[model samples]
Target: MLSVMSTRDEEIYRSCAGELTRYATGLVGPFDAPDVVTDAFLKASGSSRWDQVDNHRAYLYRTVLTVAMDHHRSSRARRAREQRAAVPAVAHQPEIDYEILDVVERLSVKQRAAVMLTYWSDLPADEVGRLMGVSEGTVKRHLDRARKRLKEWLS
Candidate 1:
């Protein structure tokens, strides 16, 4: 369906896809993340969904989460098999801002989504409000609260 979309629709969907990919990548490994994101897009663009969306990006995100969770569940056996197959022991690399992602994780899903969609995805507040099914003022409050938490955590 996306393959046959008009230019404007394609552009909007592309933006959605790009963010979905990033979100999926965070949820899974980079090696398989693209496939996960694309699979979510495929599910999202299927016939049943094309006519029933208020915010397509948020719909795509929910799709990504569902797909990624399924992937993690089904792939666990394979992951364990590969883990025992003479694989190099990967050490945990330190993140400079693990504190921030940690603090962000402490937020409720809606609050975290609100912050990430606005600050990380670079969408406007009103647009994020639409995506997260909240008013603009509500989105602003969530973002402000998330930011304050992050600032206090990282300071």
Candidate 2:
């Protein structure tokens, strides 16, 4: 049976969807943005703590990020499995920028999320920490490591 969503839930979704989509886009790229947002909302709304949560927007943000990280992990595993099992094909492969991918791959998921939320979202470190469920110092450390790695790799 389909349970009706509460009016507050609908209101929250309407207000937050655009921002969440953009945030997800920054995390996982544009092509996967919509699915990330949808998955995040589903997980957030279905959680047992959903009703008691005072900050729904922040909760959803964390959920979206978690789902995006999971997506990355599964995607990496799938690619590895395919590469191991499949024979080399002569089909033309699309050109990819390995330099940028290498830079991205060097950072941990937390570091990437911290950088994206801080730089792309223009949010302060404390806010980014809150959204990411980390302390402000942890967020700063992640950013510092990310910047050092990027500078070293790009130079």
Candidate 3:
């Protein structure tokens, strides 16, 4: 029963957490992923309407996108000063799913968000459109453009 199954509110946090973090990392940078994801989660947790939310996952996702975009702006301004010199790279996480995540990496923010919510998260176009606050046609356009780009790279 959806009732006893840990409120949809918390499920929202768990379900979209990985995809949101991945999208944020791809949009901004991996180093800021955890920070942005944590900020977004904080925002969602603080919202007054969290209890009234019928689709909390979508709400949290939208919040993540907004926070990530903000982080993108803030970091761009601070980038010159913050650029590291001769930082040693570490090995990749062995448990990471490289394929879909790779494809996600290559997409633009809008394209990636659209594709992630639609395909990876299995949300409908209309719901994705609502989450992004764009028209359904815009959602389709994002999907189409993302698909074209993916095909070009994968073919």
- Candidate 2 structure quality by residue, lDDT tens digits, 49-91: 9999999999999999899899877776765685579776565
> Candidate 1 residues 41-72, lDDT tens each?
77777747566687677777767767776886
Candidate 3 matches the true fold with a TM-score of: 0.64
Deviating ranges (above 4 Å) for candidate 3:
1-16, 77-107, 147-155
Q: Looking at candidate 2, what is the lDDT of residue 17?
A: 97
* Model 3: per-residue Cα lDDT over 18-77, one tens digit each: 877776665556666778888988787777787787777677778888887777667764
TM-score for each of the candidates: 0.52, 0.76, 0.64
**Which portions of model 2 miss their true places by more than 4 Å?**
77-105, 152-155
TM-score of 1: 0.52
Cα misplacement distance, residue 64 of candidate 2 (Å): 0.8
Better of 1 and 2 by lDDT: 2
Which ten contiguous residues of candidate 1 have the minimum total lDDT?
A: 92-101
lDDT scores for all predictions? 0.67, 0.83, 0.73
Off by over 4 Å in 1: 1-16, 24-39, 51-100
Write down the lDDT that model 1 would get. Answer: 0.67
